[model samples]
Target chain A: MKKILIITFACLISIGSFAQGNVITKHFADYQQDQSFTKVNVSSKMFSLFTEIDGEDETEKAVLDAMSKLKGVKAVVSDSGTDGAKFYREALSRVQKDGSYEELMSIQDKEEEIMFMVRNDGDIIAELFMIIRGADDFVLMTLYGEIDLNQIAKISRILKISGLEEFGKLGGN
Target chain B: MSSRFLIYLFLISSFSGFAQTKLIKTLKEEDKIESSYHLYPSTLRMINLQNDPAFDELIRPVKKLSFSILKPDVYTSKDMHTAYQELLNEGYEEYIEVVNDSASMFVVGNESKSRTCILVNNDEEYYIADLEGMINVLKLGEVYESIANQDTSKIGLGTVFNYVMGENNEKRERAKRRKEREKNGEKEAKKESFQVTIGEEDNEKKDTTSEQVDSLNAIEEKKENE
Candidate 1:
């Protein structure tokens, strides 16, 4: 009976780890089908293809190198309607409750609120999550798999991905 | 019977390669959407007509291009969403989606070799482009910037469509110039008409010009006397 209890606890721990990796998908699954929300899911295969491109300059090369390490990117954006702030708050509360991600930076003003968080695996960052809420826009984006804080800014600048600019605050790690 | 079934399956699999093309064709035919198709050569020619080598380089990897415009009355935002879902079901992965108050766009691609479609729906109309080939998706923003920032005078609707589809004004102009040159049997004048005379050559040419003017005056004086 003790052995059986130990095995069940081990299985639960493993499942929890798996769920931690997919926190964004688990939390925002409803937005995937909602017509009002714009959903984006870029597979690892696309990032791998970026590695095959020969960068034309040093900055491009650095960006490509950083992108190559990324496993995938998922974003759920709601720019229409007035529920942006509501969605942002919901996502924030859920992420906080999950306790897998640590908040890195947050900014709140009269017009907008932006938050940046990351899930770390040892010394390397495994995931970077961002939630931005403006007057009528909300964006929740997560980039997972082998992230480098030092190169995140460069990647965001070159890619010009929406809501990624918030992660640029990480500077260099 | 088994061989026949296998042959039918093979035909079905082969048609999947042109899924985006087939979709555009069907949309145009069924909904009567205004659409235009340009093959590789015509697309290249259109890019070349821009006279910007950079634009040509930007579109180098595109094998074919097609554009369709659907009026908002005919294709509502709900209809656009349904079409987007249909595209996702067709094995294309959504790379990015941007939605703003005025417009929304979805960029999706199947594989590196397959077509990348950009569907932009706004309050006014729905614009779709079927681009077949391995276009670097990363550079799409750059392409949009270049095209958007282009001088409006240079990119009239007629120039992009009528010019590529039927008329070739540039070619006609070239032929007309050639015929004029052949009729006169004179080579086209060099771009720079003024000759450069350095140092001593400059002084000598000035002196010769004055001497020729004096001689012409002398000849006129002699003719007047006669």
Candidate 2:
């Protein structure tokens, strides 16, 4: 009985350690508990609806395909009461320590730091993370999918998603 | 003989000061042209409630709506100025005129119960909302606060007034929801669905309806995702 209890406890400790080290999961939990942020989680089915958009150009189609494969999307937008810069710095350091995400590009434009990070295996990008920190706005978006940086840029232009134009430029860099 | 005089006096009082209701007459005349568009009462009631609920109470008593936004190259500032003079001559009282850096909005209406709202722009665009009830012009203005981009403005207002009049993804989604609710024996959902016909033909009068719905969907989807 003592030996069995020891083995089960060891397994539980390893699992707990694994979950805590993931910055994305940790931030999602932290944001949900904090009232200052508006959080949204969209399922894969909802993401697939982007594919149904008619009259899309070739680039739009490619982006839609990548979007459709997304497992899920999560975002948190902080309100005025919270200090965005502090939270952004904290989150960035945690993600850096997590080590799976590698910084793809970073832009420091007047009173804001926008960064894009990705987790990839060879040419296939497994996940994409975007952290935007501004004077009044702080947004962290996590898209779990096989997304390419070049495709994200094309999607941004067609959909007119502001600040995402930088992703297209990152490919050339 | 006194009663006869009273009847004669009533007829004269009713007929004397009225300016012959020229606004509705002008709208009917303009509607006959190929370019102008009007939304009749039957169409106004069909806007999908899930899209914008503001139209529900606001457009209830609207008898008809006619609007036209001419291409910049086709109509000039001089023509719009001439039309403004014609509206005043026809007894349409000018209410509010808004001039911003982007564009200008002119609003004119009669003080009577049979209100005729004529909104003209310096860009040679036009908007006419012929209502059956007494509507506060200021309240009606609130409904159109989201409108921008001259060409889309007409379709956006039209979509608000008549969403089902357009080809929209919301129409299908609403229908599916209605069906699910019906299967589940939801009374309110059934009532709403029955009020507005499902699978109706898309109004071909304006090809811009779908484009307007697309713009609205794009904006709303972004908000929803964020």
Candidate 3:
């Protein structure tokens, strides 16, 4: 009993939670497996975007574009590509017009998965996950890197194709 | 305005109108075609794949969650070299192998990009990727593609690919046998290593069990000598 207790203690001391990449791997797999990964994450932001609480559209669009550019990313809408576009529009609106800057930075870090916005030291990055299946399957979409959401959204909007009503739904992850 | 200029403008406008009429005619004819013949191959494929077991398996979570991390099991350099050749053959001549274990990506169209996405990771349980949904067939067994397009059936490409992986009876049997052989080999290797370690430890402690009896016998002999 004493040997086991010591061994267990030693193991706990040696391994940190994040250090164990296997756990993270499992989480990614599990979240993706159930199709719930994208659903939960996308809906989490849908409320904020729908209400236009703040710079939601602007932030949303940037995240969408960044995800589209990412490798392993396919389509970026479930409701429709238009909904994804609308979400991007909301996301882009949130870009720093004028704020404490520091306050925005703080709120961003607390933001959970499916959406994140960060600006610091003149550098900026925004990423968000979208429900990317065709109104059925849900897959996570990650959009991030050093670029403004507004710019990406503008470019994306210009490229929008026709025949997508669900795509126009603004509520996006 | 000169009559010559007017005539030129009229001619150009008339030609444009004529061309527009022809485009409309073509579109109308396309619309007139029956709905059954109008379905895109990719769209049909998407419908067929909805009921496939393999597709469901891909979307489901693994119980133990093992993904074969795309690393070089044989030769590291050779694996990279093969990826490069494959990219080049695929018509994306650009290649890069920057960091170890990270296969560089390559883009064949639209942009000049090099990416390493076609990796077979065996251990990383979860693989979430967005792929163009059109490709539907995979062929294996024969070294070459079928010169004889014998069958009248128009099967989705994914079906043929799945078949090659385990569709045919012969292929399925061969795969099963191969897996069994590999499992047995691994078991034997483990047992051999375990035996060697245990044998060494046992040898070191061989005389300790009977040491007390031997010591007593030595004492008896000493008493006799006295």
Candidate 4:
């Protein structure tokens, strides 16, 4: 009877882990068709092409190197007129419920709240997810597959992705 | 029976291609919409004129391009939303989207071969572009920025507008005057007699024409007074 109980508990834990794969991806899909929200998905194929480019400068070389390891990037942004706080709270709760990601840092100011979370593969970071809720905007961006915090911020600046400059604070540059 | 089947297959394939761009077609059919289409060769020639190698290389892969601009007063956000839904129904894969209270833009592609980008801004303007063949969409911003930064004085905007509007009245008038001069064998004499710079010659001609207009007006006023 004791053995059976232990086996059942182990099976339940495995099932729960399997179900909690990626909250951001699932949430992105839900809003892809929503007219009020903006979405961006860059496939690995696009990133693979970046690896072949010969950088003309040091900054370009660093950005290219960081981009090579990325599998994909997905983002969902809400319009300024909408209630950004609601989406931020909902995403925060979902991340907490998943129980797999560890919170790296968080900032709360008078105008905005930002949270950075990561799911690690041993010592290396596998995914870096960021949630930002401003007075007039809400942004959810996820960069998965072998992330380097230092270089990731540079990629956002080079790409001119609107809400991603916040990552610069993490890189301490 | 096989021949009939082949005919039907060909007809279906041709129509499916049109169906893919049905949204653009519908918008084009609307009244008061401004649209333009350009093939690769003409577009390449135009880009070459810019003399920027980076900008030229970026657009080499594009086979064809077409765009339409719509006014927000005629097409509301709700209408744009419906059009977006129709694009999804037509099997376009969403690539990028940016939406805010005042404006929204989205890019969708089909199998990496064709791309459609749509931007709608409330109470302002709306634009759509359909491009064939693959180009790095991310580098587009950089290319445009480089072009925008180029020296504007060298572009000769007045001549470009005249060319686009198909109004070359000044050129035709000058050609006619030159032909008449050549026929009278006065071209060489006139060229030898004119030693002034081009700028000074234009100013001299303008001064003479304005003086003639003022004399004619003075004569008309004196006649009325008499």
* Candidate 3 stretches greater than 4 Å from native: A1-115, A120-173, B1-77, B85-161, B168-172, B175-226
Q: lDDT tens string, model 1, A59-148?
A: 778788889999888888775565778888888999999887898888889988888898898888889999988888888889998898
Tens digits of per-residue lDDT for model 2, B121-174: 432333333333322111222233222222332443434534322323354467
Select the stronger candidate by DockQ from 3 and 4: 4
Supply DockQ values for each candidate.
0.12, 0.01, 0.02, 0.15
Candidate 1 residues B106-208, lDDT tens each? 7666674476676776554566666665444345444444444655336432245444323333544666788898866543333222333255688898999
Model 2: colliding residue pairs: none
Interface C-alpha root-mean-square deviation of candidate 1: 5.4
Residue runs of model 2 more than 4 Å from their true location after superposition = A1-23, A51-57, A158-173, B1-226
Poorest 10 consecutive residues of model 1 chain B by lDDT? B7-16
Candidate 2 per-residue lDDT over residues A71-113, each given as its tens digit = 6556666765557688789779878887878998888878888
Give the docking tier of candidate 3.
incorrect
- Which candidate, 2 or 3, has the higher DockQ? 3
Rank order (by DockQ, best first): 4, 1, 3, 2
Ordered by lDDT, highest first, the candidates read: 1, 4, 2, 3
TM-score of each: 0.59, 0.40, 0.25, 0.52
Candidate 2 at A42: error in angstroms? 2.0
User: Which candidate would rank higher by lDDT, 1 or 3?
Assistant: 1
Against the true structure, candidate 2 reaches a TM-score of 0.40
Best by DockQ: 4
lDDT of 3 by residue, B1-226 (tens): 2222211111111100011122123324544211111123333335333344432322122111111112122324444345445545644322111111222222211012211122222121111111111110111101011111312123243343233323334544676799899999999999999999999889767767578779999999999999
Candidate 1: TM of chain A? 0.81
